[model samples]
Target: MNGAVQAGYAPPTGPDRPAPGRRWLRWLLAATVAWAVLLAVLTWVSVRDDPPTVREQRNLAEAGPVVDRAVGELLAAAGDGGAARLVPDALRRGCRITPFADGATLTRGVEVLLADDDVRGLLQRVADRLPAEWRAGVRVTGEGPVLRADAGEFVAVQGRSAGPGRVRLTADTGCRPIGAGYRAPTAGGGSEAETATELLRRFGGAEGPVQVSAAPCPDGTTARTATAVSAPSRPDRPSLPGTLSQFSDGALHVSATDELYAYRSSSTVVAERADGRVRLTVSTVCRR
Candidate 1:
């Protein structure tokens, strides 16, 4: 038996070994899978814990009845006694009210159209009606006269011009959110101006240059405005420019040039077409 060997039989040595390349590939595949899983978990955590965006806050404020009720209460209070004499019928009829929230602050504003002189009188009336606590801070002057009163912590009353014949009266109350510190969710888009330019180039079919500029608001936010003129594809069928309606339903990732802070909000689009030329303007607010 030792002298005779079975046909095609060889002496056994050790267990079979995988080639080096195969081993390396296996390790690489495992690493990739682990990395992907880790990334998914982090993303889930981020989204779950992220604070609501400013736009979301604004939407909530707009939809909620609290602001409306506040406005109604203020109006009712003003209408009481002889206050009705101070507010004109036309002003009352044209009144518009909006309530919004910024961070922990809740703001409700009422706007009315009136003559320049009427605005002064209305402000005076409002000042007189404000609570005693707000009276001391109340100041009135010419050149866009404003009446402001500090009610309490992060709460105040304001009266200013919405435009030439428009006056806006607003009240703000701040109630900071309690508990864990909030972190603003990252805005997904790059530069808002760049995004606007790209969208215009892709859709506008412009014949000349596009202009983009940044305008800072009194609030800390910045507004990026992009303008372009598009040539008509055909003489009879003029080009229709961009519009907010186009992007209102879509989630946009926008950022600022200076701060590079990004946010996800719908880009405000405005478009006009005339005389075989389409004028498109896109603007979006970027949080610093």
Candidate 2:
């Protein structure tokens, strides 16, 4: 047979070729799949459930008993003045049950917080038994100080124990509330003149003594000696015009040419008047 015919008739065998690109592509795909699976697992783990409100409620419920017991102890210690301490806590916490019985009062939850679980349930029970307004008016006698506030007004009972003595209490009428607390004058017993002076200092720009010059006499009229009048230690603007004769009406009447001025020093007033002129005066009640 011819060579060409013989080669054509015989089956030819080919050499093997390496598939490196296909192998690399398979490895890359597997690594990508593994990374994707890891990310999905991490996301699931990070987003686990945590309910803050529910937890807070639970804590209150648990601490209810402890708080309730504390209230009882506080009331017993307070005796007649127990109501004072309870008022501030009730106002702050938003929940309290004050019950009146046998002419004596009992405080249940003035400071109860949601963080305690036991107290929360007790408070809820108290709420269910009492009317809503009762919570606002729960008064435990002698528990609070006069400075403790209620609603928008700051109620202070000055001279509650003054009997016949004079004591002064000041409420910063001009001061507005900041956050949960009011910007009232610091609590302490002082004469009304002193309190007024402090309020004026805070309200008005004037501080220290206000000095005044005496009228000068003509050269032939025997020139009067020059005199300096020290400002009144405490001055308050009164609801009504003060009596010109009396220095303190719990108020002061300032004039364009008046020699007297008022100021405050340590919740008290020190009045210094020009000789032959009336000295400043005021009245006050002592705190019981």
Candidate 3:
């Protein structure tokens, strides 16, 4: 047995051995990489449980449907007296989805007509209205109130007050490999054509074109909106007051002026003069 005080020279097994700290550092790096792999695998397995289908397999192009559905949920949460539109923010900036490849994200927006004071109430309503599975909640921040939730299929939903009398809701798909480019989902069918024709005739202006868009409602109904532009403003405009009188029964009105008229009758209608042309819009009103 060698004693602590043995004065013999120690035998060398090799040129030099790795430092203990260096060996531990190597293990640390290996464990970090293994932990990352495990996290990725767990994410994949969890996504498979999301209803409808697994969301991670979808590319930016294929994620449109999920985003559109999320928009519907957001709008429905805003209640029936809201006029909303898809204000897309299709900026796919660069991100590192993996060490070897660049990734991208898809963000779509819904711009709703919200008064300044309505911001808080609306955000709270959305938090409550979103599906129970989403774990929706609202938190006040330095900027303002931010409502965030999970829209199934790996989509994140957020709503914030954009400006006075306006609120913007966004659905975002975090970073992912740029599997394919993006294509917007097509709007559903609605009777916007017919309404556009009638409204144009009433305003004594011919309809140039009509664009219709529809989204699924929280109540399992298809909410539709139709808009069209009329020719140059006509002198023989139908009496704005007289025309709206028909829908005046038990309806809510706003912005009644010679240039702009907005109200919620059987549906929500807003007519305003834009660039000397009258642009009219009708949005679906779901009666709670």
lDDT per residue as tens, model 2, 14-36? 34543668679989999999999
Clashing residue pairs in all predictions, respectively, total 3, 39, 0
CA displacement after TM-score superposition, residue 174 of candidate 2 (Å): 17
> Deviation in angstroms for 62 in model 1?
17
What's the lDDT of the predicted structure labeled candidate 1?
A: 0.45
**Candidate with better TM-score, 1 vs 3:** 3
Error of 2 at 283 (Å): 12
Per-residue lDDT of model 3, residues 1-288, tens digit only? 755545687654465887678889999999999999999998887778744354446666666667777877877776542555544357586877767777788887666664235776778877887789888999899978989999877899998889765678888988755666765545566665566567666776555667766666667676666777888767776556566556556766655666666666566676767776777777773333
lDDT of 3 at 10: 62
| Best of the candidates, TM-score | 3
Best by lDDT: 3
TM-score of each predicted structure versus truth: 0.29, 0.15, 0.65
| Model 2 CA lDDT for position 161 | 17
Error (Å) of candidate 3 at residue 271 is 2.3
| Cα misplacement distance, residue 111 of candidate 2 (Å) | 32
